[model samples]
Structures are given as structure tokens and as C-alpha cells.
Target: MASEYVLRIPLDRHVITTQRSLAAVLEDIRRVLHDSAPRSALQGHLVAAGHQVRLIIDRPEATDELVRCLPDAGAYCPATVLVQAAGDGACLAYDSVASAISPYQDEEALAVAELFDAEVLSLLRRVAEPAPGESGQ
Candidate 1:
């Protein structure tokens, strides 16, 4: 059986409000992931709710040294990253499972979570910044 790991990163309300904004944010995220993890393959689709976007990242042949350290790392499962608009704010989530049997599964999961957290937060900062002539609210 596989155990799942999830990491949630919250975003400001103004960051994502409409379908156009969501699409822009998703594209930015895709670019960041592509640059950071070039080996990973990405696929995106809209969820049934029509308010969420899900991005699938497959790294079956992961070349990262950290992932390589885990036993049977070649069998690592794909990760699902979701962006959803909540009540007053938005949220970015990273979900993946530990499909391989290894003593370092938990550790690997944490490491992956941290990586996603950092990347998402960094992206948020860039996207949430105010324009040159506008004051941040």
C-alpha cells in the first residue's frame, strides 16, 4: 500500500481570484517547476469543481541526488499539485505518495514537502508583489 504526503501553501486573496488569474499563476508555477526539476514531466487539468487546477508531476527517472539516495527511488510516485481559491485567500497544495518500501520513506517525503513549500512560497512572493506605481494593500 502507498502512504500519501501533502504540503499546503497558502496565498493571498489578491493573488488569485479569477480564471485568468488562476491560469497565469499556474503557468508561473509550471515554469518554476520546469526550471527547478527539469527531469520531471508535468501535466495539468482542471478539477470537476471548476475552481481548482491540478498539476501532475511525474519523475519516474528522477535524477536528483536527494531522491537518488532513497532505496528503490526509481519507483517514486507522481506528485499532484493543486491550486484552489478559498474563502478569503487561495491555497497551493502538493500531494504525493510513498509507493516504495524503504526505511527512508518518511524522510524522503519530508524533504520533498520542504522543497515544494519553498518553491511555492518563492513563487507567491514574486506574483504577489505590487506594481511600481501601485501601493500594496
Candidate 2:
């Protein structure tokens, strides 16, 4: 009923065609990200970014796959929102519940932030959301 989360990444021009479930899509991204970097290094990147932050992703294949994964029921807040496009990158704005917590507020929170942030950054730098020149195909 309400917007939950937003995800942004580099737009790839070739894979925007078709849609898939959100979980499956994110799972792909997660796998790619983990494979691309070490946990400690990703966490350090987030720490260096100064705690809370926002980002943009431009990968379309990945985004379309994520859109396909959009669950029919039971999805975590803000993590559920599809990315919004502006210029070259797309932005994911999660619901307030997702954005309100600060990684620095507590150890557990920090851990959560580290994990997600790492995933986001890894996707941003290493993976393309779709094939080149793909836009909503």
C-alpha cells in the first residue's frame, strides 16, 4: 500500500526488458556483490562514507530483475520500493522505517548497515543492473 524502500545503481542499457520478483533479483545482486568484495573492505567503505547516506544505480537489467522479484506479500520496508530514474542513475528511497535507523546508533545497527551498504556499493561499482542499452524491454 505504501512505498517501502528504494535502490539505485548504474543503468545498463541492454537488460531493461522483462520483469521478475524482487527477492530473486536482489539475491542475484547479493551474490554478485559478495563475490566481488571482502566483507571487511565493504564495511570500511561505508564507514569512510560517514555513516548514513544515499546512492544511485544505473543498471537496468538488475533493476528489472528486482522489479520482477517484487513480492506479492511480506516484504521489508523501503527495501521494497523500485528505483526512480533521474539522468544517468536511479535512486532507491526506502520507507521511513528503513531510513530512520543509523548504523552508528548501535552495534547491531552498525552490522546491518555494513552489510547492506556493502551490497549497495558493490553493486554500484562492480555489477551492472542490466545489459548495455537496455531500458524497460
Q: Highest TM-score: give the candidate number.
A: 1
User: What lDDT would each prediction earn against the true structure?
Assistant: 0.47, 0.34
Model 1: runs farther than 4 Å from truth? 1-20, 30-37, 40-50, 58-67, 72-77, 95-117, 128-137
What lDDT is obtained when candidate 2 is compared to the true structure?
0.34
Q: What is the lDDT of candidate 1?
A: 0.47
* Total backbone clashes of candidate 2, pairs 3 or more residues apart or in separate chains: 40
Candidate 1, 1-137: lDDT as tens digits? 99998534332222333222454556566665655444543223334357777655554333253455653444433445567765444456543333222345457654653454444445555544443563322
lDDT (tens digit, per residue) of candidate 2 on 32-98: 5344334233311111133223322222332233234432101221232233333354333333212
What TM-score would each prediction reach against the true structure?
0.41, 0.28
